[model samples]
Target: MTVPVSPRHDETFVLNLGPQHPATHGVLRVKLTMDGEYIVKAEPVLGYIHRMHEKLAEASTFAQFMPNTARMDYLHALAFNHGWALVVEKAAGIEVPERAEYIRVITVELNRIASHLLWWAAFLLDLGGFTPLLYAFDDREKIIDLLERITGSRLTYCYMRFGGVYNDIDDEFIKGTRDFIKRLRGRMPRLYHDLVTHNIILIKRIKDIGIISAEQCRRYGATGPVARGSGIDYDVRKHEPYSVYPEFDFDVPVFNEGDSMARYMVRMHEMEQSMRIIEQALDKLPEGPVMAKVPKVLKPGAGYYYSAVETARGSLGHRLVCNGDKNPYKLKLRSPTFSNLSLYGEVAEGMLLADALALMGSLDLVIPEIDR
Candidate 1:
């Protein structure tokens, strides 16, 4: 329903787009000012899911805060785990083993694919398609099973440790990943691209709808698919180059359209790139111990340390302040969803209510990360 905006009406109405609505995707409420079916403004109300994550980090030891990272962005918990591990390792001067680095890369890429799959399913659902959700979840289940073999948990994983990962990938896991990669590559063209990407309805609903200029993305600090869709080409893994990511060769997808379809296509292409990375990591998988040698007590020098990783949404960063104590003095998280959602108020204005929801879904928000 791409309803055109009418001239300024004599009256407008206020609508609450739910703290419990499915379209909001979490405990988020958007106070939308509407002129008929056109949105005049959208203000997202947060804090429904806030659990004082940073405060918990300050109160607990460095190791104690590991599980909390997963809870923030439950779908892409591995990226959060990787970011925390990197910051702690940076502060403690810990060098990870070569084999462990490769393992981390493999599992993280797997998690990224799982995240994008979930996003695809949910986004399609938002647009009133149910069959794709079933197909996407059927594929995502394989990734979860593979990760569950090593990580031991399904949704929120604390698999990564300060120097290395909690467990190593076995031969079965390797074979399973390879088989899944082959299966997905074959299905992408028939199941996803031909079925959805080329559909005239989806293209018309998303293409050139809710156009966001590159300058608007910069002003709001939007990253991940949102920024890349606007042709920014800023990926933390490629531009910042952390962990074993530099060792893998992959292309960062960039689309200049700056619309919902552009963002959707960016993620669709990113899943393929992630598969390429996983394949390369498995090919060059080194043989050695997964864990590095380190002391039990982790107390870095009295200073500030920072680390960032490319998560499914965008750049997830952790800033740590230490006083040479077992517990961090201060912990701050830079979650990309917060920055991406911040621009909704500006962009949603004058857009049809349905189109605004499409734009919001394109941002691929995880509310716990923003509320954290």
Candidate 2:
């Protein structure tokens, strides 16, 4: 049995939070030590929903592993899918066609916007506000619709090919995306910022609560907005530019506040940056073969390969060891949520139950991604 940390010099109460709580956003069990309603310490106990995705990936061929990507981060399946595809492409020196690269950027950016929107909704809902949930879904639904036309699925899409995308985008898809970006950009200020960012209650709830400093972030291996919130000045998209990210013009938002509000601001700014990337991708759209010329039977040389991509949650890495055989010998996923969740125990200390919940929300953990 693990001993609970006492918030005070003496006298401490142990609080059992959920494997069923709404604030957790998934089936997460947190052991919290409390001094009244304020959390003295927080510990996350995982594996309730673990599917052994790494084990499953090792049993599948290079071509077959793409579907498993979606199962990890269902909210941002395309980003996960792209990460897997890019790694395989890089390992075998397979070149993706120009048009395919452009399509990949567009779809991934759209999915990113959707993931951030969902986080905004859930984060607000966790803080006792309900309207943002519906508003976020309204915008997210547009992206889902635009992607479903080609991907043939919404939640868990298997749309990416090894060296390219599975299908070519049409005029209707491009036009729909243009309209969606415009509508979302116009509404975000009114619906998200004015209604939530400036709300006195939200400000009081998150401003200085559940803080994590720059040093603590380094200790915890934090990445993405969580690291950026502490002024880390690191974004995998920029540090390790992949896909068409090198061609895009956007800024990685950073903040030095190192609190829940800073994390929230980072995500909001990222959404704007994602919109900018989408508009540029749409305008610079090219035409060519969407599918690359790949072999019917892939036998990559036995070697270890590591690839990382910036998901909406953070940096997602896939490490694989192939044996020049039909299937992967070993596979490992370095999920952003895994690193982000590690900071929860340290940061949630001395925070109220509501503040802890908000802090977890700001981390933007998709439990499936972590547990996988």
Candidate 3:
């Protein structure tokens, strides 16, 4: 598509990045007003994907919405699954067994690592380093196979239930997880840092670029690594403990620099923290029933309840209004990417078009979540 020069403002023109572009990752369109490759303003255009999730929840039973959770953010689907379960469980006052909580934490942390690994791969590819992309995927595939063994889906998982997970992890899953943890712990430095992070070009490309201040994060309600990268010490798993997360000891990686490199470093360190959580949970794995004894058809009492989980991208909130019915009265999802992407317009204004794309990549957006 040709972007004709504006005769009145000869140096400026409006350009559409994509409703279908590889850099946009999903069906995300951005209308940008640019002056000679420098973006004058950036406006994200959403709604390419229909949400209907809240309406669907109102029509379907509590248990039936399990699959819908995964479709929103397929990269971190299990976290969505956990958030949905937490929503119904909190509203219904369901008691999950200690063993099941541990299982959920373990699975969710593995998924988090997998999500970060994929981001690392894709982000590197965006930066024009294709070799690290292969290495990143090689590491991510191990965790993916491990998750598929128990969750039964490699991408969009429907493994979580109202009270606990739908299935119990066997010895094979345990062994696979342990082996994966060890392998990733060993290869992370050489494959990720030495190959990509420390490269001079990579450093020039990301470091001190697209700076986001802590004030900007607060203004935009950005969470996860984006906030953490800007020196905001808020993580849902820590700030509002849930599941078996409080039991685990891990550090929240923060970088005060607030640049694209800072965000990249935060995720890189987070993968280590996730593996640490996974190892600790494995060592303390309890032996009991994974599935809780809940009604076949779950009908939460009349009330309003919300649940928040720390996904790969950040805080994922699921709010529900129940009216003593099998289906919810209303459901609202607070997606982190939506809030994080909101700041893109302000941040991208003065940056070069390439750096703007880099900043977008650093946000690790799952567009369907924003569209929803």
Candidate 4:
């Protein structure tokens, strides 16, 4: 005799995971449709910290707009400032002095290192490792000190002008950067690489998890380490070549693994490459005008211009639709974190909670940038 089986229903739960949780990073909420620990579907709900930066830019003058860029990515404010300034300079066809260009390159690269160090620290913290955060902060403080001396600000810096930098670098500033670079170089192997990269727990946690292929990355417009980890050679600095980057020699690190660990390795190697760029730039540092001559009150002709620069996270683009007026007609920013976050829904499907957090961390989503 055989027993007849009855059609049965399995209960499911709708989980509101974050928006207040420590793992969410900011005021980020994830609505998850789940069956036990595995996520059947995931939706990232944004707008928690919306500031309407694009619309606000339209009401401000070209020169007045530089400060707003810093508010988007508080971690890499200079990159945003540089991105907007470069676009405006290109649009207006203003020539930046050679010295100004080198200073821009050096400062941006140093900010990149600072940004990556913070990421490294936060990433390790996400994995339940705390020591790397302290070590990373120790290195980052030196960069902050050097930048503050020249820029007169630290976190949300407004140092880049439309045609050049606000101030020139002094001997003390140069010496600070050079010494900090040497210190970071010496500590890289012992503190960063050995401490986290060699940690068996970290390796096991990230490796072979949250795999994203090259095709998916391109489809989603993913840039930076997330895209390069998928074997795509798409660094804006190399491919587009802006702001004296053409004069510098550096390699864009690529990894074919397309996993979280690959993303980690790519960023780690990128830190080293940033150091190389800085050293080269310092060696060839020259004496010249640091600011380009431009009228006190500026206005560009009516037209839309788009420009991009590689930030610590990835490619940052600015779209300005100018009306030839003092104020912009319209403005938009293509933040890398926005595009990188777009891939989250597809990548997080069917993943466990731990794996999803790893994937989210791998994308390096900056909430302000996303909401801007």
Name the best candidate (by TM-score): 1
> TM-score, each model?
0.98, 0.96, 0.97, 0.96
What lDDT score belongs to each candidate, Candidate 1 first?
Answer: 0.93, 0.88, 0.89, 0.87
Q: In model 4, where is the ten-residue run with the lowest total lDDT?
A: 1-10
Off by over 4 Å in 2: 1-10
lDDT, residue 1, candidate 2: 10
lDDT of 1 at 252: 98
Model 4: how far residue 97 lies from native, Å? 0.3
What C-alpha lDDT, on a 0 to 100 scale, does residue 215 get in candidate 1?
99
Q: Report the candidate with higher TM-score, 1 versus 3.
A: 1
For model 3, the stretches where C-alpha displacement exceeds 4 angstroms are: 1-10
Pairs of residues at least 3 apart in sequence or in different chains that clash in candidate 1: none
Task: Report the C-alpha lDDT of model 3 over 235-286, residue by residue, as the tens digit.
Answer: 9999999998989899999999999999999999999999999999999999
Whole-model alpha-carbon lDDT for candidate 2: 0.88
As for candidate 4, its clashing pairs are none
- 45-97: candidate 4 lDDT, tens digit per residue: 99898999888888778888899899999888999999999998888889999
Model 1: how far residue 75 lies from native, Å: 0.7
User: Ten-residue segment with the worst summed lDDT in candidate 3?
Assistant: 1-10
Error of 2 at 354 (Å): 1.8
Q: What is the lDDT of candidate 3?
A: 0.89
